[model samples]
Target: MSDSLERDALKEILTASIKEQRAARRWGIFFKVLTFGYLGLVMALMLGWIGAHESESASSGPHVGVVDLSGPIAADGDASSQLVIAGLKAAFEDKNTKAVILRANSPGGSPVQSGMMYDEIKRLKAKHSNTPFYVVVEDVCASGCYYAAVAGEKIFADKASIVGSIGVLMDGFGFTGAMDKLGVERRLITAGANKGFLDPFSPQSEEQKQKATAMLQEVHQQFINVVKEGRGKRLAADNPDLFSGLVWSGESGLKLGLVDALGSVDSVARDVVKVDNIVDFTPQPSYADRLARQLGVAAATTLGAKLEWQLR
Candidate 1:
């Protein structure tokens, strides 16, 4: 009886060990699969394969396409013309896009970038005449942001949204006084007569200042012409402050014919486009791209090389 009892005890121990080993193997497999899935997701995000408009497809049915334009627009920024234009192209080319809306919230940026976007919007609008293009402003759409907004068929904004800064300025620091007090002299040699124009450490030149002022005026006139061509008779031409570089509330902008009416993106999509479903077509930069851009900017700053000499 003692032998039989010992044998039974041994058999039970063997069964328990087998069960434990099987469970450990199963758990190991589960953990390995979970880790791989997580890594895949991270890779997809880093490659921009899964982003704002990842779900864009024909099966989505009819929807309003939205392209976001926010922050300071620049060649190396998220709101650059290249990205914005890419979004616009995608939105226009999509068969299910009932309309395209540019959701803007920017204090403006590079005029060149803004102009490229504006021209693309116009081109897209003409190509997709059946699909209406609109601009919905949030926060402030002044300066370069407004420059692009004018290309839209209609401009919508909240009553309190800030709009319009129809002017140009060349702003810089003059460190000559501080340098003089510090007994530091700057020695800059250039082959061109105006090569050292607007040097902060050098003495101010009246001729250079006049030239800068004239250039600003010319750009300002170009901005004014674009606005006039866009707004046409709707603009309140009698308003002296219309192009005076002053920002105004959306309510005041309506009076000046700067904005068509007060509305939001949702309201426009629902009421105007007759589509409640909206898909973002804005191209979000991948993590790798963003990191590269940041590195480039850092290098430029360290080298004291200005990426853009002019800002809108």
Candidate 2:
């Protein structure tokens, strides 16, 4: 009888344990469903809010596409040729847009990228002859930025703004002395005799200097040609130093015929364009993108801490 009772007790314990496990699994599934459902509801609400906001913004009249040319004019830069071109295209495509503005604030960058943007802007203007294009200089629109400004029908600048840098530049370092101090030898082999003219660690020959200067002069000539084409009769060519890579303030820039008018963003919008509403077409990072970047940084920090602890 005792043996039978022990057997019965064991069976009862096993059954209770199985029942408990099954109940736990069901609760686990319920929690997972609840979490996913909550996430879906939050996403739906966010989307609805975004849609409503966008609808309200669309109600505003006279869409003015504002392209921000605010930094180095390189492929990877904020004022990259690609981004500027995309903004200009958006402006041209917007049916409600009466004018497009290139809002510039830069000391300039790559000549090639600036030239390409200038060409694209001219082409777009030609395609849309009805729409007017203006360049509003913010702070310092020099060199490549000035080249771009000439492409506009009218260039405007703030009274205190700095403008005018019409020149080309190529910069590199000479590391011959540094390498010599470190007892390092440069092993550069080239098929052409003049191919390694600008090698940093190699001694610069007189011939190389002459060759580089000639190359830069050629580029400068190209820059001058583009400015002339864009500015037409507006540029005052009395001063040769205008193209000597020198910058000028807005007031002086007006005397040099570098800019058409002196005004601020509000002035341009209210008086020049005769539109009170301004739309910015500059691409901005989304909230989700910012959140992901923050999360990534946090994760990297955590991993680094754990690794440091392990190393210690």
Candidate 3:
């Protein structure tokens, strides 16, 4: 009876050990798969395979390289200079590309980001003298969008498309009234007098307002200079509201010299570039990169909600 009991006990221990080893092996396989997936995602992003819009079909002959300029032109916006510049560079570097087209569709955002892209386009133009760059406004290209548009050799749009808002503005909210209604008092401290110049919780300061207006005027002037330099002798010199932060239809824009003509992406590619095939070279963010950026944007927006300051 004792011998039989010992045999049974040893068998049970062996069975439990086997089960534990099997579970360990399963977990090890699961972790390896997870790690491989993560590494593959990283590789795809580094190779510019994911999030990027590639050509639909392969072309043997000359093609018109197109890049999209959609959404706001802010640093954290979809149409940021970093992505646009990368797309433009890729399009320009392609030997089979006869010309480059920037299909702009935006309400404008940041002037600084726009300026950076403008500089890059100009540099690329000089480097590739044979390849011409053009802008085709789809919906709207106002303020900063127009700033970047001017860098192109020609700007086109549909007859109904909105174009041009050549100006700068700084805007904010005054929460003092709201706070007073709610019986809440704000206590903000600063080291420099001008540091809290535009704080919403504080009373409005005439000096700060004037300073802000003057700064906007300076930026507006810079915008005007770029338009003049790019349009060069094309803009209607007699129109007083050309730089007055006013927008116009494509038809009016054509007459005002804001747009060269009424055209679309297809038309430009076919008639101007003389090619039917349009290859979009927009650098799409990888899934992981996009997820990371989205999270960052959410965090920024949440933080910004605490303040009431916005610039245009």
The best candidate in terms of TM-score: 1
For residues 20-107, could you state the per-residue lDDT of candidate 3 as single tens digits? Answer: 9999999999999999999998888775676566653335568888999998776665688988999999888888899999999988
lDDT over C-alpha atoms for residue 176 of model 2: 84
Q: What is the lDDT of candidate 1?
A: 0.85
TM-score order, best first, reads 1, 3, 2
Off by over 4 Å in 2: 1-60, 284-312
On TM-score, the stronger of 1 and 3 is 1
Candidate 1's displacement at residue 228, Å, is 0.8
Poorly placed runs, candidate 3 (over 4 Å): 1-59, 292-312
Candidates 2 and 3 compared by lDDT, better number: 3
**Which 10 consecutive positions of candidate 1 have the poorest summed lDDT?**
302-311
- In model 2, the clashing pairs are 143-165
> lDDT per residue, candidate 2, 1-312, as tens digits?
999999999999999999999999999999999999989877755545333222114446786667789876655556767768887887777777778899999888767678889899989999999999999999778887887788999899987888876766555668889999999998988898876766767887899778767877888888889888887778887888888878888988888888998986668878877887888777543345334544553321211111100000
Assess candidate 3 and give its lDDT: 0.83
